[model samples]
Target: MSGFLPYGRQTIDASDVEAVVEALQSDYLTTGPTVARFEEAFAQFVGVRYAVAVANGTAALHTAYAALGIGPGDEVIVPAMTFAATANAACYLGAKPVFADVECDTLLLDHNVLDPLVTERTKAIVAVDYAGQPCAYPALRAFADRHGLALVADACHALGGSLNGRRVGSLADLSTFSLHPVKPMTTGEGGVITTDDPDLAERMRVFRNHGITTDHRQREQAGTWHYDMVGLGFNYRLSDLQCALGLSQLARLPVWVERRRELAARYIGLLAGLPDVRPLEVRPGVGHGWHLMVVRLIGACPPGFRDVVLAGLRARGIGANVHYKPVHLHAYYREHLGTHPGLVPVSEDAFARILTLPLFPAMGDDDVDRIVGALEEVLEDVR
Candidate 1:
């Protein structure tokens, strides 16, 4: 506990290390059996028919959008509160990302706010499960259906989360997940796309491998070197070494998510004493994966107060951070997309006050207490 605690981190055990070592010792480092095994296990875990592993989360989003046939002039609706990658992926495919406001309490994509953003050119809606609570998928799904638009879930923060009984990966037309070290599970640097449609799955598989009809493994199995590049794609393949680690880590996901929830509950109880600091609301029937322990500074706390709190906590070795600044507010989006302040007021307001406190599966209840205690002291000092 000597070092500064991070807001989120990977929790790897000896088994994870062993898995990677075994993968390294194997004949295939990439495009091999281990990758297929991880994909199958992940799909089954999330109640989806297919999962295609890729280089990373952004690649997953890019592949998902491409699979849905989103292209130039296509507009994709996405919440402003999410990571820039959510919107940037759409940009990668020459699709415009139309920013939608998030719900105040949850920082989740507000389906109600999406109506005004939809246009004739709207090709899809990307629902971001901000801070690991699944978005209002039922509403979003229904909305997408009415508009004949594809629904994609930017579920990088919500690998193990669910709404009702349906898992995050199974909640949309195509769901993308990050397997970054800080995510629910780690593959060092990797991502996967989940879908019930076989066609979409195949598209993503091809998309990750330079749009080639056959991979080296397939060519080797068939005893032929012939292949065809059907479409332009990126070399976004996830290696077998990472997949081996992911498979090991995926096995412990349920337990890790449970621990995260337990830590979140502990944070809630401890922060009750801090009247100005309020935890984000968890919607009913949602099983949050709690990738971030985000809280809002409500009551009399004004804009810039969150930064003060962040500074104070860092001085005390509590690694408090902010989840995001709204993507639309970023410089690139403002210049290119004509986005400006007041575009999504709710998200703008939340961005100013929200703070992400340390929360990881390896953290103890005492860690939650320490973080809350530090937050309390920071608030008191600011006053």
Candidate 2:
């Protein structure tokens, strides 16, 4: 049998190895020149004026929230279908997370669903880029402008995605991305926040390093040790080593994103004829980065049909996985926020039927064929 096909993974070549090795050989490993270079390259790639590298995507969100002054009693509207990080970051700043419904097809925040959820306490709107496609940014911008709410994007799944000719990083006031192995790029474990606002960028830089005014390198160069804790923060800085890997990965991102799009098209075409499944749809004028090729099982899933299909696929060495369960469905949210079953009907429905297939840059046609074949077999058996 062939090896297990992961839902997603990183692709590292010799060039990536060389970049990490070179960083290891350098004098500064933790916070070095490489971090700055990576940040600059990312900013340029995303068409943003400033990018702040953080330890992880969650940190980027937390920093962004803090920079926006999101605090006690403030409310941030978050789509209920995304990773917990989307709402958790708001909670980190003692802000309340108001749940929003996503569109049934794309699993993205619905513009039509925003009004009922907005109130005077609404401080921001965090539009998630679900399954790598950019959210409705123009509508979101209008909504934010009308309410004077801070607009941010939890774009962890959309690194190279674009909306209406604008890269995701520049689409919101503060956009965040993840560099986990499964994401579009990997830095082992890292994240970045991109924005055109200089003050927000500077605040994030300080917040990532324990709210210090100057980094260690700056203090060392001045031949003095003078720094102050202007605000409460954490050690959320990305290491220079990881930044080196990220930089190398960033160089190949354009091609990788294109390949992902191609693979996604192939999946869509192959799955189009399947009556039991429906692939997530991409909107017009938006470029999907194809983070995860998710499909929903249609109709009555026959009790454990979903689980049985997942088990059958795994038995055949296919790592079919569930992209997510509704954020509010978790025990903590249920207990703390009084989150109940029908908070967002569409999201809850999706959580029950969604299944993510393997899709990555390194995958080949044979791999796609293998997954499709395995899924077909599983579906036939379950049905």
Candidate 3:
């Protein structure tokens, strides 16, 4: 047996621990200035006017959907090749999630297929930044504007990713980020919603904290013990302790993202001549976060080839995995959306060939070499 290399892992330092420790020592652990500070800092980092911290990525998505007033009878277009949360958020709002095919190269939503999916019922588009590469935002934005749809960037895998020099969280009407432990940065488990719209920001803030009109800080500062419940909301608030960890992790995000990019470049160079595997095409204008370095196994590879390669990598201490099955292929979606196998051809085809190789900021040259070596060996065996 050898040391297991996970597909993704958190990189925490002494400073991160110290920040959490300081928060633990403070009187206000859950509701405090740390959360506010984190929100402000995150908003500034992403060039957004406001940010609302929430419990997790799903909560962030749900809150964003709710804030946008998406409900039953409305349709939200989502890429099929993303995590289920992207589509599930629409379901949470009792809104239908219209599945769209992805581009063959980047695996992000294909704007070409979007127009056909738009209807009078379409209220929004939840564009995912698959594998940390930002989607074609300008095209998507134009499409959304043409259809009068709200564009939400499900940027959970793309915190540090950007397009046309603008950051991912600032590119859409509203953007959501996940700070899960395995992400580029971590707050143990947390998320944030960013937007420039003041009313949307307020709606998100209200929805994240039990629908309360006033937060604890405001109540405490004003010495008012009573509060009003403005609307139906959830207990989706992120604690100050988590926010402390987030602030510290955020400070190191630029360095971490750069390292991930370097690792991705190395993977690209090492895998270039390998005939059986192809890296996803990254367009020039985007700054990819490289959260997961996914590759498509090409040629006469069978449908089970990805699983075989994944198993081989695991046996060699390299934790290779798949990014996702098309959301429409999921049982729940098939049952609810009445989606069948052949609905999104590109997304389904990509799903069978795609494999997520181990990638993280802490990975070194040797790690890359080991993964490359294992992949080469696996491909040779398959051939």
lDDT of each: 0.92, 0.92, 0.92
- What are the per-residue Cα lDDT tens digits for candidate 2 across 223-305? 99988999888999999999999999999999999999998888888888788899998889998999999999999865567
Rank the models by TM-score, top first: 1, 3, 2
Least lDDT summed over 10 consecutive residues: which range in candidate 3? 297-306
lDDT of 3 by residue, 190-296 (tens): 99999999999999999998999888889999999999998999999999999999999999999999999999999999999798899999988999999999999
lDDT of 1 by residue, 235-314 (tens): 99999999999999999999999999999999998888889889999999999989999999986657677788899999
Candidate 3: which stretches are off by over 4 Å?
none
Candidate 2 regions off by >4 Å?
A: none
Error of 3 at 50 (Å): 0.5
Candidate 2 clash pair list: none
Cα lDDT for residue 233, model 3? 94
TM-score per candidate, chains pooled:
0.99, 0.98, 0.98
Q: What is the C-alpha RMSD of each candidate to the true structure, in Å?
A: 0.9, 1.1, 1.1
